[model samples]
Target: MKAFQELAETLSTTLAAHGLVLRGGFNFSAGEESPTGPSNAPAKSVLLVGQTGSAPWPHFLRWWERQPRDLKDPLDSWSREVIGAVAYEFGARAVSPSDRPFLPFQQWAMRAEGLKPSPLGILMHPEYGLWHAYRGALLFDREISIQAPENPIHLCDACIGKPCLNSCPVGAYSADGFAYETCLSHVRGPKGAPCRDAGCIARNACPYGTEYRYAAEVQAFHMKAFAGL
Candidate 1:
């Protein structure tokens, strides 16, 4: 059984090598404790999450520059390759928690050997604000012991501007809560002011993630996914 500290160091180094910055709350667990749908079988695993940095644009540019200039619309192969490699290397399964029901899936991940919150949303680093995301997650079968992630600090709590809330042209995200349908309509190319450019302006205005900006193509990809396009 590989210990958690050993695993963290390995993953942190790997992500750093790829230009990603490892934020707080790098949670890991045995495969026996991971999220699984009611019908989906659970597997032994561990999860590693971190910010992909401010410039995923360069990643997109590099991917784009790889093929013949005439070829357009890069394939999903690149994402699959990146994600798959992480999964294989870590002796764990990999996935974004959002791929399933948000709350339940997260709970499943936190159930001791199941699933757990990255300590105070520690994985939810304040710097990238919420603009960054866990680009990939790995699940492993081996039991690896890791130190508790650093206690998380909610950066949003300190912001007077509350830019993430105000920046939304559509006002999709409200302190009261999100209006998903309205946001969905606008991103799907609905006639609206806020989401015209693919996502929430408020999110873009977030100072935390200014460095780890999402590439335009990644934003488009996410917007299309959100819109169910």
Candidate 2:
């Protein structure tokens, strides 16, 4: 147990240098779906990697500035490179949310952190709120002692106004689910400058974790990407 804790700490420190955080981790249960290793072996444990707010912006910007400007999905590519290196050093298999077959990353996050989805479909962290994101996961053959931490409260349950659902100009998010086409059309249209320049209105409306909110530049980058600009 002590050794595992130490290993986890070291892993945390290593990720921190790259502005990443270990959102949480968990060991697989019997007969559960899991990520595979080189030999098609099932992973016994998983550690989720993510960033809080703009924690990774500085590092990403510095690295991005060096690469070709025409690269598509730079953020996703960067995440793989950084997290892949960490996984290699730690003797783990790295899988990304963008990976084919799309590993159940959202479910894994919920199980690992005991977080529920907000109205916008992003996990709501008590501290980080909607400002954080899970980038990838490290899969290990050894069943390290890790499990999800439970948070007693779901922020949405207590939120009365639900400003997030209402802030969108297109009403993209709703109980019926996300209107992806409507959203995409709106974002690609001329009126999208507000969202493209400042980020999603609904996401920016969340009152929680305001301090961790992305910087204007970071938001602009994401918005442009989201709009496929």
Candidate 3:
């Protein structure tokens, strides 16, 4: 147990240097109920791994540019490579957000961080808003003690105007649900340049965690990715 704790501490510190954090974790020893776990593996715990804000973007982009572009799903490939290496070093299995039989990352994140979804369906982080992301996770074959995060105040609850809902030109997000086709069509249209170049206007309108917002370049990259541009 002490060894595992030490390993966790070391991993947390190491990952932080790369702008990744051990966001949260859970123990799923035999007989424990969980909606998401390795179906074919003897996993006893899962560590939620992710990044906050744009701190990792520059580093990731730098590495990404150097990788061969011939491969499909470069971003997912990179995440799998890096996180997989970490898992190898630590004697665990690495799983990415893009993996087949997709792991319920949102559920894992909600359980680990006590989070609630924003209107955009991205988890509303008290300090990161829509600026954070889960990259991958590590599944261990032995239980590791990790405390569940105390629930933070849900920012969307007290928002007066809900600017996020009002900011989009196409009404892409709303109480009814995201207008997927509306958003896609608009983003692919002539007037999409601003949205493409500056990221989602609605997401930018979010007042919480303004300080942690991604840089314009990072935003543009994500926007392009979303638009398949």
- Top candidate on TM-score is 2
The CA lDDT at 147 in model 1 is: 44
- C-alpha TM-scores of all predictions: 0.64, 0.96, 0.92
Best by lDDT, which number?
A: 2
RMSD per model, one decimal: 6.0, 1.2, 2.3
* Clashes, model 2: 0
Q: State the lDDT of candidate 2 residue by residue for 1-229, as single tens digits.
A: 7777898899999999989998888899889877785346998888899999899999998899999999889999999999999999999988999999888999999988999999899999998889999999999888887644877488889999999999999999999989999988988898888888888899999999999999988998987887688
Which model is ahead, 1 or 2, in terms of lDDT?
2
Residue pairs clashing in model 3 are none
Model 3: lDDT of residue 182: 94
Candidate 3 similarity to native, TM-score: 0.92
State the lDDT of candidate 1 residue by residue for 21-107, as single tens digits: 433332334343445422245544445453454444466457767778555334344443565666567555556544544423344
Off by over 4 Å in 2: none
lDDT of 2 at 99: 93
